[model samples]
Target: MALFNKMLASIGIGTAKVDTRLDSDRYLPGQTVQGKVEIRGGSVEQKIEEIYLTLHTTYIKEQDDKKYTQTAALEKLRLNDPFTIAPGELRTMPFSLVLPNDTPLTYGRTKVWISTGLEIKNAVDPSDEDFIQILPGPIVHAALLALTDLGFKLRQAECEAVSYKLNHHRPFIQEFEFIPVTGPYHGKLDELEISFLSVSEERAEILLEVDRKAKGLAGLFAEAMEMDETMVRAFITKQDIPQMREKLNQIISRYI
Candidate 1:
């Protein structure tokens, strides 16, 4: 017996059945995810008006200085224009969906949920929700590793809305903060902020901001620095612990 049969048996629905199959268990951003939806008529003939799939994501939003949990439809697809299923008949439909390049990377594993359903008139709805684990790409991993190698320890991470007019592009931005491991720079630098703008599998833009401590003397203020993608990648590939310390010293020396 098929898995759909087991599901239908549990639901006690003798009129309809639904099943979904994903092409792969893992995917990167900007990649195509393909899948198929299979529907089988139960013990009796059924009118399958339409089938649809919805991609859903759970995120947090802020309003009135308060945060709220919410879910949004990332993508949607209509599979059929209205069809009928005879008794014991099987029907299948294929679908292809593209994931956004700027999708936030989850810590361990996050679920990409796809809901498949059939809309029928004057009857209970039949649907299935499948979860797929999303993995981080190479660029993301490399950038994080570089930060750790620079004697920075992870503090906290959050996602905030950014404007495209500002050239941020994506609807959200992931912010990570790190503190200097140990050195005279510990008290001199408040923290380092990093954000990743992944454009593709191999290309990612990193934004770095340094929060410098203010001096007590006159004409002293905090300074900020920003590095582009090339500089960041080069730093990742070329710098060791001593070299990174020297680079930081150079940056601080310029301000003094």
Candidate 2:
């Protein structure tokens, strides 16, 4: 029976299992996430080659008319060296992984998670996935709040393909689309889209697309022809905001 159990475990019948427990439900970019992976042995002893943890998120890549959802690996961490697990034994390993400064925020349909994998010799590897929410970092949070203060109403946001000029690791980026209901930009603009290509504690790089409100007969023709939008790119340090809010008023004036 013992021999049968070992063979069965090797074939993934009753193998060791992994469970990851995070210290918190929410994490921020550039923050070190502390978690523990608990491995519980199954019916028999097994030799685990190594343990790995990875951060994963989905991206959409379109080819022709079909779209494919591809998983992007933000980071990987090797948990430990090879070890043996006796039947019914439980081992807990603690880990601290620093999130990427540009980790995509969990907004709308976007999802982010950490996966734990146990590599074993000649056996179907066991794995576990734990989903978590990613909140904007300090600089990003402040910028979003400032936009709210400026009367820009944030609407839908999504992760999509970004141009190379944005300068990002992954092939896509998250854009927050806004429309001014009040404040300085109210009537002059039709839409505004902001993409945070690079975000850190000190500074953040932004890509802004401004759509001008059409007017007059020529403007009406331009609107009909879809020629009313302009794109702007800029970067701001943490020290720039609030005052930058006032400066933003001036900068947007030029865009209009």
Candidate 3:
């Protein structure tokens, strides 16, 4: 029976299993995530080579005129050194990691999760996945509120693949689309797209693409040539939150 059990464990029939439990499922960018990795042993003794946690999300990528969803690792954390587990044993290890500042918010079709994995030789490694919700940080949240106060309503949000030159930190970026519904820009602009290129406690670097409403011959011609759209970068700090409405108005008006 011992030999049979060993054989079964080797083939993952009774191999060790892993599960990760987070202190909370909701978090903000740049916050610390605390969790525990639980291991349940199988019918026989097995050696675990390593345990690791990876933060992952999906982004849309275009290839050959077709779009595909791709999984990406935003960050990784390795825990507990190699150890041995006896039959029917249980072990729990605590861990902590700083979430990446560029982690995308849980919006639209974008989903974020933490994957826990175990490395074992000659066996199918056991793994676990825990989905998590990422909320906008203080600075980013303030900007969003400011935009709403200025009469722009959020239309959509999504993550899309980006070039290395655009963002050296990550392979994708999250974009938020807004349209004027009631305020000063109601009749002047077509739409607005915003991307938080980089964000932190101190400041947030934003990229704004302003689309102007086409008018007569000159405006129609500019639209056809793609000149009706303008792209610009802006930096907002904690102090700027109070005046974000005015500041955004000035910046966007220059383009319109």
Question: Global lDDT of each model?
Answer: 0.64, 0.85, 0.91
Model 2: weakest 10-residue lDDT segment is 242-251
As for TM-score, the candidate ahead, 2 or 3, is 3
Query: Per-prediction TM-score, please?
Result: 0.65, 0.91, 0.95
Candidate 3 regions with alpha-carbon error over 4 angstroms: none
Cα TM-score of candidate 2? 0.91
User: Model 3, range 115-174, lDDT digits (tens) per residue?
Assistant: 999998878899999999999988898888888988999999999988776755788899
How does candidate 1 fare on TM-score? 0.65
Q: Which candidate tops TM-score?
A: 3
lDDT of 1 by residue, 1-256 (tens): 4556545534556767899999986777667779899998876566788899887655556779998655556678888888878768988889998877766555422246778988866556689998765565665665566567656788876665554554765455667777878754476566776667555654565666666665564315223222211112123222233354454445433432
Model 1 worst lDDT window (10 residues): 224-233
lDDT (10s digit) by residue, model 2, range 141-195 = 7777777778898887778776777566888888888889898889889888888
* Residue 149 displacement (Å), model 3: 1.2
User: On a 0 to 100 scale, what is the lDDT of residue 223 in model 3?
Assistant: 91
lDDT of 2 at 144: 76
User: CA RMSD for every model?
Assistant: 7.2, 2.0, 1.4
Give the candidate number with the greatest lDDT: 3
Task: Choose 1 or 2, whichever is better by TM-score.
Answer: 2
